[model samples]
Target: MPVPPPLRQRILITGASAGLGREMARAWAARGRDLALCARRPDALERLRDELLAATPSAVVSLHVVDVADHEAVDAAVDDAAAALGGLDRVVVNAGVAGGDSLGLDGAEANRTTARTNFLGAVHQAESALRVFRPAGAGHLVFISSMSALRGMGGAMNVYSATKAGVSALAEGLRSDLVGTGIAVTAVHPGYVRTEMASHFPRMLMASDPDRATRAIVAAVEREPARAYVPALPWAALAWPMRLMPLGLYRRVAG
Candidate 1:
């Protein structure tokens, strides 16, 4: 029989201070998974750590404050997490931003910020995570992309969708390159989930609750699939239609 991959005991998640990241930490902690939570806020991280420890005293929860856009800082934080956890079995590149405006309508800085945080930040996290995974010869890397990645979006979602598309592509490339290696990559494409991130967005139709969304995403990650459309109901069924929709109608609904 083929040997199965080891249980991913130690998990490192970026953007873990709040929203989906925080909820994912809680879910994994309940499962007795040791976690390294990385974010820009120390207080939030500490609060989450305390909450997890209170709920599951045996779970080891580490914290690291980091800005994912800075490759050097990502390197340091990821390395630090690995060291603290005695080596990382999994890394979830979940940190990202959703701020953007229409091209020409807004300054380049707005779009640039989104690009740096969403796309480049993912690149940095993947690079740093691989440094440890490659040496260890085993690891699971998960990327939290979006349903927006299925097709081009309009208005503020344009840049965000593009960034997610890049992330999905990155995950696919890694999966291809690491075919023979024990390392695994999973791309999670989530539709609008009720969270602070979605609150900032308008026109979120049939959005799933935070708990439901977290469950779907965590379940998909555990499966270590090449790509997953989370919640599987509407998002999975909607992917093809979204891709095949007429541009005029797409723009109307997407906007």
Candidate 2:
């Protein structure tokens, strides 16, 4: 019998322009895997593609300008990237926004935008990924959640936390639905990575740089765990207590 072909890993990552997503693209490409990179910033995407190719001339990096909030655009971009990559081996739903309202504030628009991007946007990606994987009988669905998703967060983090919680639940549902199927689903909860999104913070809590976080993420992803905490240090250990902390204490600590 003819030998089966080697596994092809054409990974698709959203929000690949900057932050953790950009690091993931660079890290994955360094391993000689072809990548499908998408982000809202076309210029940044092109620059990243150039950087990746320059580092490893043999790597395949396809760029797409995409706004994850646009469901139709997400579908189209994913389809085009999968086609270019000869079918996707993995889809990382990494695009997300951290802004939202504080209670008793007029930030409804901010919360809505966050909801549309973090929750609905992720839903669209999952649906698109399933379409590509179901027939092919294989694919990895990676959801980028946050440590804040462990419980309802406060203030500006409220909606962001809620959205991540939604995605985490979505990942679990997908896992249950896809059991015994070739398609695998994983949820990664990353804590305080040093990214532009958190640049304005007075100080990050247990912050790790993007490169280190990406290393842990890539490792966890390769193992295809149902759930993982990137860098798996204080965050994994901290999650339990953080969830169980009384509201008053939590508020004081968070404040």
Candidate 3:
């Protein structure tokens, strides 16, 4: 049998106050991973830190209150977290916003907000993580993209989907750039996973509950693949078909 790869022990996760980030933190903590949890809500971060530490006494859980849209804050937070946890073995760029409306209908601000938070914020996180990882010569960088990234979407999903597409492309580009380095990059395109972020959107077919979705996401991160259609059942099977579907039919099936 092949030897198992070493698990990433020190992890940094943004948007860790709640939803998938929080759940992923719990999953990793259960496996004895030290975590640096970042989010805008200090109280929520504190509660989660306490909960994780209480449940897994051996784990180190540090909290950083940050708005990922601010690059300077993100840089400082990532560096601080890395120092707190000794060193970072992995970073999960998961902070995002779903706020956006129809284009050219006085929704520019909303669309821009989504774009900055989802795409630019991801860029900031990735840049900061690589700064720490480069010297170490080993790290896992995971981007939480969306299944919507496979194709262009319209209406409220327009800007949101576009940002995810950029995120996926960013991960691919980074993976290509780091070919010879020990660092690994993974872009996880998750299907409709029930969470606070997806609450406002109309639920799609084959939507997954949080627990199952977190399991799939964590499992994919552990594998550190270039890209993973999370759950790896329906989303993985639907990737090509979704990309190839005609606009008219794709809208009907996806929306």
lDDT of each: 0.92, 0.90, 0.93
Runs with alpha carbons beyond 4 Å of true place in candidate 1: 1-8
lDDT of 2 by residue, 55-172 (tens): 9999999988888888889889989998899889999999988776676798788889999999999999999889999999999999999887888877788888899999999999
- lDDT of prediction 3: 0.93
Report the alpha-carbon TM-score of model 3 versus the true structure.
0.96
Error of 3 at 43 (Å): 0.6
Error of 2 at 127 (Å): 0.6
State the RMSD for candidate 1: 2.5
**Quick one: best lDDT, which candidate?**
3
Backbone clash tally (model 1):
0
Residue 37 miss distance in model 3 (angstroms): 0.3
Instruction: Estimate, for each residue in 1-255, the C-alpha lDDT of model 3 and write its tens digit.
Output: 999987549999999999999999999999999899999999999999889989999888889999999999999999999999899999999999898887988779989999999999999999999999999999999999999999988888899999999999999999999998999999999999888888888646799999999999999899888999989988899999998889999888876
